[model samples]
Target: MDLTYVVAMGSERSLVVRPPKLNSLVELLTSHGYSVVGPILRDGVVVLDFIEKFDEALIGVESAPRPGEYRLEEHKGAVFGGPVGPMSMKRWINPPNRIAWSARPEGDQVHVDTPKPRGPRAYLGIRPCDVAARTIFGEVWPGHPDDLVIVAECTSVGETCFCSSMGTGPAAGEGADIVLTEFGEGSVLVRSRSDRGAVLLARMNGAAATEDEIESARSRVAAAAESMVRSIDSEAAREALASMPDSAVWDSVAQRCLACANCTMVCPTCFCTSINDTADLDGVVQRTIRWDSCFTPGFSEIHGGVHRDSVAARYRHWASHKLSTWWDQFGTAGCVGCGRCITWCPVGIDITEEANRIIKEVAHA
Candidate 1:
């Protein structure tokens, strides 16, 4: 299959390819020692998992996700219908239980060892919202491979989605090797952003997309963004949180919150972590770093006692950090607006609503 490669200004190329050729793209990445990880419907939930084949990739399966309610609905013959789910790229690459290093103490000298770095991993069907989260997380943790981002633009919005408000997507931004836009009809508009992506395109042998096809892709992405029913006033939200640290709204929100930490766990940008030392029966001690949530009691532990003892205090800290202080640290807000925190919360605690509520109350006060 010989195909023409249309060179753009710098290093960008666009190709229109048929659906089955997606498998060829996967094969190419695997041949280069990349484990292809993408969306799969497992146990009635769309999650990021290993992709052995594109047919079972769960691409067109749409998730009817609301605050505290979620179910999968089949969108037959359509690919890439589902938006962001409870899982994100963070689960596959960064991981929750990543071990930084292991040390064993023998007499006066201690032996230290770190886990060997694994091969490159390719994340297929990743949304633009989560891509934004990954970009933010990469600034802090810094050592993952660079060749593995394959973004998929959303064709439809989820019930709780608000990525459009965050300006992160419905369409992917930069930092992707390959970006796929599935516009139904068993066709996909493929854009290559790097040299590796160009190689994969050459293998698939796709032709340069027609101008009409590119226009159709743009229209699809725009429609997806407009279809989103939820949005937040992020600028107002920042001002509200910073001004009202002792806002009475925190007490109301806390009463409904279970403090189960489900929101933080599902949040793609949340990077709070904790470390602990464990000893085995074989007289070997190992230290491990694991995901931690600010909602927990021990999260703010000190010599005397826990700092944020009340649920209200913990909730305040969580919201404030995500909307306010995170900007001070990263020059941008921590949330990517995927709304997984809203959908997965047992009580349907919508962060966007809470942020708006805070702004509303503070303005009146």
Candidate 2:
């Protein structure tokens, strides 16, 4: 995998690779000591998992995602079919549960041991919305420079997708090293966004994309954006949520919300974590970090009592933080509009609908 040819080539131009040739790219990554992870069909749905070959990827299968439901169907139209699945890049970058460190008492001296570092990871077939979510995750939990981001720009739109409204997708945005847009049949347009990506592209055997092919790819992405029916005005939603703390919509949503934290669990940008400490009888102590959700009553526990004791308050906090105060804190909205929260929730709580309701209420008042 000599990448010096990239420097020799000088120009980083888009190329069109046949679908079957993607395995060569995977092999190249593996040769460079990268553990390639891509979308694969599991339990009747597409999920991100480790892959050694491109055929293992969940290609030619489109996902139909709606509120409270998800279904997969065969579609020979594109290579990578779905927008996204329940899992995001967060699961690999920041795990659900991780042992931060462990300590042992050794002859009146305390010894601390941290977990070993993982090898470089290559995220393949990642959607643009999840790419944006990964950017947000980098802001809070920064440190995965070795990770390679290979984005699969959305050519097909899902029922619940709203990434266009969030200004995050349909086309791949920042944080991606390489971008791939699969056109009908076997052709895929690949572009390099970073030097490392250029190196990979240089090694790949492919023809330079024609001007017509590029324009066609762009048109497909634009069509996907236009097809999105669900949306939220980020600025308006932020203002609405900030102004209405006592809005009855909270109570209404709370009535429907099960407070099961399924939304938070599936959300790509929800990085709340809880720390747990345990000691063994042998005097070894371990500290672990696990994913936590604001929907949980214990999440807001205090000396007096739980701050957000009511389900309504909890719902309000989660929604407001996602669309409102998160701007003040992170300079960006926490929600990337992937619609996983909506699709995976048992009762189908739509964030865009709630945000719009809040905005409408504020306007009327």
Candidate 3:
């Protein structure tokens, strides 16, 4: 082991040694009764949702370039676990378009369609940035606008992320219980920093590590942080571009934009949504929610009007919010820089590339 992978009960409660291999490591947790959830290739993308078992899942999985191109193929044996896929924290925590409480007609009135209760969940494979996103999400979802709704406790699993740039990634998980890392084939490194996390790891088995193993895990985390290729000085860039909302940047992107909502949909933090209703055969109604994008023609439609009648206005709002207003509203930038937005933008609108161009143009002039 190159780093301290496992920390046992007793002494200082710090990192111990030699990360366990994937399966052996997982066996430790599962045997101890903690359910493990992480990434799986689904619908052609490596998404962060739930998985029943590791049997056929997490195998032959791969993720390609970002800013949002996710072309995953099956690659065998101790995969790098790749970057945070196009999936975001929303899938696991928010339960997309949750009924927000549904409704059904009572004999003479309407009754609320209370959602099924779900409880403590342990998820694996979330990148550091998503963890930060989960924290950011908490502020918006549960505190002010809505009531306290604690979705789950992510007490176990691997941490492969580079949210450092956004001050959210690179594995600073005050929000996570157990952060998992793959040390070698079939082996994993579980480090529990919190009480809940420690309890979960206590159930898993692996001989306590010698000094050698602990160091091994540390090295791997350092490597993971440095290995990140997708990052932006989100704070700096956002500040620089803040006053340029009416600049030529939006128009440039609009020229190449397809009005496709792909970027917003795949983004982990883009939370805009559209709601619609369906009537049953009996003329009853039900509501459904699907992802929404500013690029869409109707997104900004106003009374007999669209507030953003021009493609420029619509696109400008998105970039500005991601780079600007998001901070005002949530005290954080809306973008996590997962790169999914770039890879899947259909016409391939590279936001970083666009930002650079705009900055350069401004500086030159």
Candidate 4:
């Protein structure tokens, strides 16, 4: 349980663990004082939640995602059958509601207290796109150093996924501590990307993977990337948004958009928040921070009036910020191509389609 072992021995080696042995990984994490969270079946969908055992995870569950549609179907004998669920790593890192601080009157003095620190946590079975999303999110809201990230490389593509175009996945990227690739034959290839990951992996005691086994697992991930149907050129989309503010595509999309903030809520990278303060009769004042959306009128409200008064304007601002202006502020696009926005949106408003439309129109103009 001593996690301070930082020497990365055999960091370049790939290890193979049989499916039944996966439970040991969870036990190992728990023994090391890490709270493990992974995908679980809830309300007929896969969602990220705490898991005490490996059986609690959605092992054979695959997600069917389309514009305005999402379903969890059984994929017999497949591990990590889905590309991603509706929830992302954001929910755990930045919760929906959190107490910033509290102040109480104590006999002619005020006592202020901040929330207690959360202990170390491990995210198991996280998808590569979400791994990328977590990295982008950290730029705005820093993450804990003690948290561990275990990424599951995609072997099957989702209908709305576009991570290939975004250069985020199918294969695990740089942020992951441990990367797992399931071959659908009751075995998984595991690789460590960091010193902590290497130390933990060594404890799993998995056998060294053969070159053929490693090549086959990587080939499956490559096939997943090629099979993706939806995509948008990030550079072109950025240029399109900057050049065509008055494009008719905004009005057309606004007609279908309800401005209910579903897209922003489901988006992995949207980080807008609002702070509220409440006081009780007992002279206790509590301040809390909660997630907010740009689609909300109050979000753009100033001293006089709301800046984005119409649905068209609000939609324009959101899509622009995600694909174009985000680069100006963060030096990277805000979206990681998880496709949650398209799947969860009530009206099936596809950001990729909308961005592509702008790009098409700008090309002819």
Candidate 2 colliding pairs: none
What tens-digit string does per-residue lDDT give for candidate 4 at 1-365?
A: 01111111354655544345566788889998999998777888788889887643466668889999998877654566487878888898888899999999999999999989989999998999999999999987767889999998998888999999999998999899988877746456778888888888877754567777777778989999999999999999988998888999999999999999989888888998999999999989999999999999899999999989999999999999999999999999998899999999998999999999999999999
lDDT of 2 by residue, 1-365 (tens): 11101111224354444444667778889988899988888888888889998743455678889999999977665566577889999899889999999999999899999999888999988999999999898888764689999898998888889999999998999988888876656466777888898888777765566667677778889999999999999999999999999999999998999999999999999999999999999999999999999999899999999999999999999999999999999999999999999999999999989999999999999
TM-scores vs. true structure, each candidate: 0.92, 0.94, 0.79, 0.95
Q: How much lDDT does each candidate structure score? A: 0.79, 0.85, 0.58, 0.84
* lDDT at position 133, candidate 4: 94
Q: Judging by lDDT, tell me the better candidate of 2 and 3.
A: 2
Superposition TM-score, candidate 1 onto the true structure:
0.92
Q: Residue 109's C-alpha lDDT in candidate 3?
A: 90
Cα displacement (angstroms), candidate 2, residue 250, comes to 0.5
Local accuracy of candidate 3 as per-residue lDDT tens digits, 161-226: 225556654544566665655444334455665676666556554566555555665566567566
Instruction: For residues 1-365, write the lDDT of model 1, one tens digit per residue.
Output: 12122212113444445444567767778888888887777788888887766645464468778999888877653465477778987776568997778778788777888989777788888899988888887777653665488888888788899999988998888778778776646467777777777667666654567777777778989998989998877888878899998888899998999999999999988888899888777566777889999999999999999999999999899889888888888988888899899999999999888888899988899
Error of 4 at 326 (Å): 0.3
RMSD in angstroms, all models? Answer: 3.2, 3.6, 5.3, 3.8
RMSD of 4: 3.8
Worst ten-residue run, lDDT, model 2?
1-10
lDDT of 3 at 198: 66
